[model samples]
Target: MTSAPPRVLTVAGSDSGGGAGIQADLKAMLANGVHGMSVLTAITAQNSLGVQGAWELPAEQVEAQFRSVVDDIGVDAVKTGMLASADMVRVVAALLRTLPPEVPVVVDPVAVSKHGDALLGAEAMEAVRSEVVPLATVLTPNLTELGPVAGVELRTVQDRELAAKILLDAGASWVLVKGGHDGGDTAVDVLHGPGTRQEFSAPRADNRHTHGTGCTLASTIASYLARGYDVPSAVGAAKQYISGAIANGFALGGGIGPVDHAWQFRGSGQ
Candidate 1:
C-alpha cells in the first residue's frame, strides 16, 4: 500500500464557477502533490463576469466542517479564503488557535472578486485584521487589500513594505504583499518575515483570464509548507507555479476567466 501524501485543508467559500475560492485551493493543492480537504464557509453565485450573490454558512456549520476535518483527517497545513462575516472569521480563527504551533496556516484576505464584487464587508475585514491575521503563519494580501488591512494608503514600493511590516507586527510570521494589481511590466511580490525580505518577480503575463490568482498562490504555498518547505522556499515555489498558471490562463465567460491550476499537467496526456 502506498503512503498518503501530506494533507492540506482549505477553509473557504465555494465558487460555483469553479475558478476561485475553495475550488481553486483544492486544485492547487492536488497539483502540488498534497491531499486536499475543505471546510466550506460560504457559497457564491459566481462566474467569470462576477459574483451574482453570496450566502455565508452558519457559524455552527462552518465550525462543524472544520472540526470534522481536523479532528480526524488532521491537516498538515491550512489555507483560508472568503470568510464572509465577522462571526465566521472569529469562528475560523478560534478553531485555528487550537492547532499545534507547528501547523502552518495561510490566510488569504479575500475582500473583493476579480470583477469588483464584494465578498467581505467592513466588519468582517476588521475581524480579519484582529483575529485572523494574528493566527496566520503566512498572510497573503494583494495590493488592493493591503491598504485597508494595514490602515494605510500604498503609493510606492516603500509603502508596500511598510504595510507588510504592519501586518508582520500584527502577528503574522510572514506577509506576502502581491503586486499583481500594480500594472507594471513585471509582477513583483514582496515576502517579509522576521529579519528577512525577498522580492519575487515574474514577467507579467498578458492574459486577461487571470482570475483566481490570489487564492491559487496562497493555497500553493500552504501545500508546499505541508510538504516540508520553509516559509521563503514555499512562497518562492508558489510564485513560480502561479506565474505559469497565469501565463496559461484561458477565456471562459464574457469577463475574466481563471488561471490554469493544472498548467503543469498540460500536454502530459493524463
Candidate 2:
C-alpha cells in the first residue's frame, strides 16, 4: 500500500493559461511530492500572452471553500495568492487566525503578473499590508511588488534587499524578494529576516517562456516547508527549482508561455 503524501493547500486563483495562479501552485506542490489541495478565490481568462479578464469569487464562497478543506483533511502548510479584493483578503485573514500557529503559512503577495496585468485591486492593498501579511509565516514578493509595499523605488539590487527588510518589518516573519524580472546577466533573489540576510545569484536564462516563475517558486517553498524543512533551506531549494524550471521552460499557447512545472519529468509530460 502507498503511504500518504504531505498535504499543502493553496488558496489562490485559476489561470486558464496554466502558467500561474492555482495551476502553477498545484504543479509545484505535486512536483515536490506533496498532496496538492486548493481553495480557488478567483478565475482568470488568461493565455501565454496576458490575462484578458478576471472575476473574484464571492467572499462567502471563499470562506466556505477554506472551511471545507481546513475543517477536514487539514493542511500541513497553507499558501495564498491573488485574494483579489479587500473583503476577500479580510475573510482569508480571519480564517488563517483560526488555524493553529504551527501550521506553516506562505503568502505570495502577488500584485501584478509578469506581463504587467493587474491581478489585485487598489482596495486590497491596505487589507493585505495590515491584515493578511501579519498572519503569514513567509511572504514572497517580486521587485515590482516591493515598490508599493516598501514605499520606495526598487531600481537596484540594494533596493531589493531593502524592500525585503521593509516587508519583514511590516509583519512577515520572512520575506523573499524575487529578482527574476531585474534586467542583468545574473538573476539575484534575496531572503531577509531576523538573524541574517542571504542573497543568491544565478546566470540569467534567456527564456521568454518564463511565465509562472514567481508563483511556482513561492509554492515550491511552501511545499518544502510542509515537508519539515527549515525556512532557509526551503527558500534555497525553491530558488534552485525555479531557476532550473526557467532554464527548461517550454512554449505553450499564444503569448508568453509558462515555465515547465514538471521539469524533473523532462519532456515525458508526466
Candidate 3:
C-alpha cells in the first residue's frame, strides 16, 4: 500500500447548501492536496439565500467526533469555523489545547454567513476572544468579524493592521485580516505576526458568487501548512489559491453561489 497523505481536520458546522462550513473546508483541503476530516459542531438549515435554522450539537458529541479522528488517523493541521454558542466555543478551544504544540491550527472566526445571516451567537464572542483566539496558530477574520473581536471600526488598511495587532497580541501567533469587504479594485489581505507583516493583494475577482471564500482560504492555509510550508509561505500560497477559486466562482442557486474549489483542475481534464 502507498503511504497516507497529509491529513487536516476541520472543526466546523455543516452547511446544507454545500457552499461554506465543513463542505467548503473539505473541498479546499482536497484541492490543495490534503486528506480532510471534520468534527461537526452544528447543523444549519442553510441555502444560497440565507440560513433558515440551526441546531448546535451537544458539546460531548463534538468532543467525541474530534477524539475519534485524532486518536486514530491523526492530523497534520486543523481549521475551525462556526461554533454556534459560547459553550461550543470553549469546548472546541479546550479540545484544540490537547493537540501537540507543533500542529498548526487555523481559526476562521465565522460570525456571520455570506448573506449577512448570523452564524455564531453574540454570547460566544467573549468565549472566542478569551479561549479560542489564543489557541489559534493563524486567525482569519473578515473586517466585520474583526471589528467586533478587536473592538474597533475598520475603515482603512492601517485600521486593519491595527486590528490584526490586537488579535496577534491576544495570543494568536498570526492574524490575517481579510479585505474582501473593503470594496476596491484590489482585494488586500494583511497578515500580521510577531515582528513581521505581509500584504497579499489579489485582483478582486468581479464575481458575486463567492460564498465560501473565508472557509476556503482558512482551509487552504491549513492544507499548505500540513504540506510543510512555513507560516508566511503557507498563507501566501493560500492567498493565490483562493483568488483563483473566487475568480472561477459560479452561480448555484437563486442567491449567491460557491467559489470553485476545483478551479485549477477545471480545464486540465483531471
Identify the candidate with maximal lDDT: 1
User: Which lDDT tens digits does candidate 3 get at residues 1-270?
Assistant: 988889999999999999999999999998899999999999999999999999999988999999999999999999999987899999999999999999999999999899999887667977898899999999999988997777678777678778888888889999988889987799998889989888999999888989999999999999999999998999999999999999989999899999999999996221
lDDT of 1 by residue, 18-76 (tens): 99999999999999999999999999899999999899899889889988989998989
Candidate 2, residues 107-154, lDDT tens digits: the string is 988889878988777778778888987887888888777777566787
> TM-scores of all models?
0.97, 0.95, 0.97
lDDT of each: 0.93, 0.86, 0.91
Question: What overall lDDT, based on C-alpha atoms, would model 3 receive against the true structure?
Answer: 0.91
Candidate 3: regions farther than 4 A off: 268-270
Model 1, which residues run further than 4 Å from truth?
Answer: 268-270
Tell me the alpha-carbon RMSD of every candidate: 1.6, 1.9, 1.6
Q: Which one wins on TM-score?
A: 1
Better of 1 and 3 by lDDT: 1
By lDDT: ranked, best first:
1, 3, 2
Stretches of candidate 2 above 4 Å error? 155-158, 267-270
Clashing pairs in 1: none
Q: What TM-score number comes out for model 3?
A: 0.97
